[model samples]
Target: MANATSGMAVNDDCKLKFLELKAKRTYRFIVFKIDETVKEVIVEKLGEPTQSYEDFTASLPSDECRYAIFDFDFVTEENCQKSKIFFIAWSPDTSRVRSKMLYASSKDRFKRELDGIQVELQATDPTEMGLDVIRSRAA
Candidate 1:
């Protein structure tokens, strides 16, 4: 159902894919885009389980806003392997203001549909969502 306040609808594929990633490690990340003409958010890309963070970063456009989730895996100081789901709000500086505003307004509604996210990151530039930063947060 689309929320009355934002008129943003999260596609069922988004949740189904997220569940596969969170529970089965079937994907490395998922990229979401808002289709204003449809007034709905849809899956733009599904990163393969073998995809690297660099590949995930490359999936994002230089001058557009996107919502994505990365299955971040890391080892703790004690050498325990673990993973965390990262919800990223990507609004690049070069993106149009109108597109940014729409994504910003609809992010919360869309994120709420994905239940397993453990980390939330809002990045205007790549540096802000660097691996080191994600690693530190995972630690």
Candidate 2:
């Protein structure tokens, strides 16, 4: 199934369903943790309509917890009203992704700053990532 919002192609409808699951009123955000090496940081995206942090811990293969950070960097009424955008990192070996830090002047001014940086950096995957914002939440 393809995501209606982000336009990403989901492998199946089940993933789409999971992505569309409604958020709770008291939705939790990111869980930030540092691994033993502490050279890198991990930020797990967590919230309602999916497994809780406690549940994830119970199911994790290693007792060592994976750290993550949540960034509701882009949430708008035009988008899914209850939606949040998160950037989570587990390890350098885990994924290429990094911290949840958004180096904007302020939260309200992130989009503009992001656009400026995008142009400055010449992002290879530059297709306007608000759609990815939805796709990541689905996973």
Task: Choose the strongest candidate by lDDT.
Answer: 1
Per-residue lDDT tens digits of candidate 2, residues 1-139? 2223322221232222223332322333334333324322233334543444344333322323333222233345467433343432222222223321211111222222111111111111213223354344534
Q: Single out the weakest 10-residue window by summed lDDT for candidate 1.
A: 2-11
Clashing pairs in 1: none
List per-candidate RMSD values in Å. 0.7, 14.7
Error of 2 at 26 (Å): 14
Query: What residue runs in model 2 are displaced by over 4 Å at the alpha carbon?
Result: 1-10, 23-51, 63-139
Q: Give the TM-score of candidate 2.
A: 0.22
Clashes of each: 0, 9
lDDT for 22 (candidate 2)? 21
Candidate 1 per-residue lDDT, tens place, 94-124, comes to 9999898889889888999999899999999
